[model samples]
Target: MRKVVFHKLCAELRSRALLEETFHVTIEEQVAMFIHVVGHNWSNRPIAFEFMRSGETVSRYFNLVLDALCILARDLVCIKSIDTHQQITSSHGRFHPYFQGCIGALDGTHIPACVPMHMQDRFRGRKKFPSQNVLAAVDFDLRFLYVLAGWEGSAHDSYVLQDALSRTNGLKIPEGKYFLADAGYAARPGVLPPYRGTRYHLKEYKGTREPENPKELFNLRHSSLRTTIERAFGALKNRFRIFKCQPFFPLKTQVKIVMACCALHNWIIEDGPNVYVYDDAAWYEALPRSVRNHTDMHQENLAWAKKRDDTAKMMWEDKVGQTVP
Candidate 1:
């Protein structure tokens, strides 16, 4: 982190009165300690030894910073309306008319977690280690709009998404605006997914294998756009090393750490340097493909399928007209 960014954060915390100079530890040291904990996943003992303080003191101030960051989350992480008209009118070619009403992309990522022996089964999914499934939505700019963490690793992506939709104050979608999701999620009123059994991942569309049909074209574009969330996840995990490994904190504190990291991620995106580069090819090759389940398809699901078909047809016709020779 830059010194200017660090001082800026200190100023903000001081303005909120969240941090003040202790007798021995100054506010800057407290903020630095918090950053070290989140950035490096340093345990209380190591942090205390480095700061010349006791483990108890380090733990107390660490929790205090965590609580403060959680409190600031509301202001930092938010969903703002994108200007559809300007986006379509701009020079950005592929996303113009097709993604006009699209607000952002949504996806689920597994964050490593440490759980008790009795509860490890529920937390351990396909991965050998225990983890938590986190659902997050990010806009084109790579800023997180909404995040739901703490779901057990074994929980399906659709299940976590369903929980998100069921909450009274959960993920909100405007009437016409929709978010692009991967095949792991059902294409519904507020969520639009690519056509099933089609080429969706970016890796599938490398080189001469371009879209052969309208559905394929839509899938290609959808994969390109929806991969934004994966890049967001990569950037988040890359910035905060705590996500790379399972911290020794309890399950509940681990959840809070996820949320706190998200809040800080957004803060860096907004104020920090433009260091987060979205490497699509590398990211696509690294992540495991999400398993798609088509069971229990309902009436609304059918309607969403029809909606995708109609949108694909419209995009194809538009492309044909533009390429007329």
Candidate 2:
């Protein structure tokens, strides 16, 4: 942030004639407006005081920055390359290529907010609060890829992705590449869900409400793949602290704040470890030791478990169904 602010934005903008988000404001003005929005509780009063600008001007410039950020985010937050194999590299480290075939770890989080009395019915979430449902995807790098805001809190995770996959052309992920999700979603060609069982962590289990079979193995791999999303969500909530609390804004504004936080997360990581005081210890301490991985819960059949897992499942699925090359 310091480098971007002090060096890139400040120094560079002053040196050149800058393009702007809107004709009503300059790029520098938009930056200031953006900083004020994220810095304050995004309240118009505070923004007016901080910038010594009228609320109207602040609102104008704030939207300009947000619009630009939205466009940038739409382009940048997408899966660029997907490699399915894990490659061992001697110098840099072991390369986890399996993540390449995967787009992101996806989960739906509740973003609370004030709602109109009449509209509140639709906005009521699983927690029974007035809010918006935010569906986010995080890559292995912990960078946010997709953020779907503006859904009513009552919406389910499966419904959220269904809209994204079916409606949005830009998000047209190839047929074979899959994303990791929790059991909130059902399994299909391009999405995977975790196993439902008394004993899990393996790629497959025979103890579901449904019949036990090789297909059940997909659930186990689903659990393993979906862990990344849980960790990502945990870290995000811990960092913001506000996500856990009810948002005071109206449902519309709440969506804006959620997207802004995602952008901020990218900004913080880009600034590196020192720019933000990331509570790595707090996060680890919060994790259930038994739930860290499937093995952490004491899986007795380790070797056999690995075998029944997805060595051929992904291959067979590709042979029979669609496979991304």
Candidate 3:
């Protein structure tokens, strides 16, 4: 980390009195220890060896830093209003007008977890490994807007999404705003998903064949935009190695780490250097394929389906003049 960035963090924490210098340890060292543990998934023993401190001391400071970072979550993980003017000029600007009310993309990712033997089965998913299902929503800037962790890995994406929507204060969509999700989720009034039985992933569009119809065109654009959340997840795991592997911590601590990592991710995007670049293809290839049951569309679902169809038709008509036969 740069000196300026380090000092800025120290200033913020110091102002909040969330972190302070111990008898022999400065706030800088404390912050460095926490970053090292999260960034590298280092155990207390190895961290103690590196810092020349006792294992217990290292563990204590680690908890303090973890708690402090969690306290900053409210300020870090926040959803911003969509900027229509900016979106119209963005790299994916052509499709911006069609999804003018889109807030971000939503998806679920599985992170390895360590649970008691009796509870292991509930956390084990298709990967045959115990894990936790983490649902995250991210905007175009690659910042996490909302994150819901701690769900058993065996939980389905749609189930987790329903949980998020059911909570009184959980993931809230504005009156007209919607979020882009994949087929694993049920398309509804507040969420837009690609048309089923259609090419969605970027790898599917590698050949000379392009979108043949309006639905294909809508799916093509949706895939392009929804990819931002996948890239965000990739960037998050890449920066925090703890998320990449199962850390030797209690289930509660592990869950907190997930939230803290997300909070830090947003902080880095807002204030840190712009060195993080997302590899869409790499992330897509790493994902595990799971079979999802087709959700029966009901009354509300039908209305949402009609809305999606209308949007697809509008987009196709707007670009029909430029499309080759």
Candidate 4:
């Protein structure tokens, strides 16, 4: 800065300004990421000093960015760009590529957070740590359709969806049109979750009895659709390694960073072909069937638990509103 001062920095500033202007995503997209994902430890004195021309710039600009992401997520309808096709088959075989008739896969991920002293207990979840459970829904092409935030870690995945659906009525998929999800979600008309038991690609088996006839067939069909989401999540965490780390910030900051990483994921997938492929075979081969079965049974079951679980869900659903599409 001392050597180059205004002249050289001005040119770089102009380039940065121009870059920001061209994207269709509003300034919120820029700001949210600037704070949450791109600028972690931004408040640390020396680190802040390194990035900002002035010390106060980060704080001054932080809320400005936060407001923008909020607006972008609420108002913008993202139109996907995918090449869909259909194959010629007289009767039996058909193959082509498009969005692959896959709408989206919904999942919940817990982000570690610095919970407030007063409410820390409310946020402690499965791992016995303070965290925030964020629920996001994405299309088969791995683009985010909707993201709902502010869910407590202890809350069930089904509860998260119910809250999002009730709060945002527009998200209701039309009749017979469904978004695929793991068994963690509730079973309703427009949301199709996998059937319990048995196996399919990326499916984790729970101890519940294997699904009967048509349900098994439905899961088989849905597996092809849902894999995209898993792949998308894997790519996202891999690229933004910090997201994989336990969040040790305020709950509010956790939300901001989560959204930022998601935007970053979309940005990369849209701009390039760096989508990640998971080593599911490696993970599966290393894990025993009994362990996999035990893990799957627990994690994939937010909808129907055992007798204790089922009863809890019944009570929880009453408190957590249900929206039928």
lDDT of 2 by residue, 1-325 (tens): 4656334443333343333445555566667666655554466777778768798887766665555555444434554445442221211111122234566677887776677789888989777677778788776667776788888889888888767665533234444456677767665545555544533454334455532344453444445556666777777676665576665555666677677667666655555322222223232122121334546433432432343346435534543553255
Kindly report which residue pairs in candidate 3 clash with one another. Answer: none
**Candidate 1 Cα outliers beyond 4 Å, as residue runs:** 85-93, 272-300
TM-score of 1: 0.87
Clashing residue pairs in candidate 1 are none
How accurate locally, in lDDT, is each candidate? Answer: 0.80, 0.57, 0.81, 0.51
lDDT of 2 at 244: 65
Lowest summed lDDT across 10 adjacent residues in model 1 is found at 279-288
Q: Judged by lDDT against the true structure, how good is candidate 4?
A: 0.51
CA displacement after TM-score superposition, residue 255 of candidate 2 (Å): 3.1
Candidate 4 lDDT for residue 185: 69
Tens-digit lDDT track of model 3 for 60-91: 88889889888877566656554443543464
Best by lDDT: 3
Worst 10-residue lDDT window, candidate 2: 86-95
Pairs that collide, model 2: 82-100, 83-100, 195-219, 203-217, 203-220, 203-221, 204-217
Q: Model 2: runs farther than 4 Å from truth?
A: 5-29, 39-42, 84-100, 200-225, 235-253, 267-325
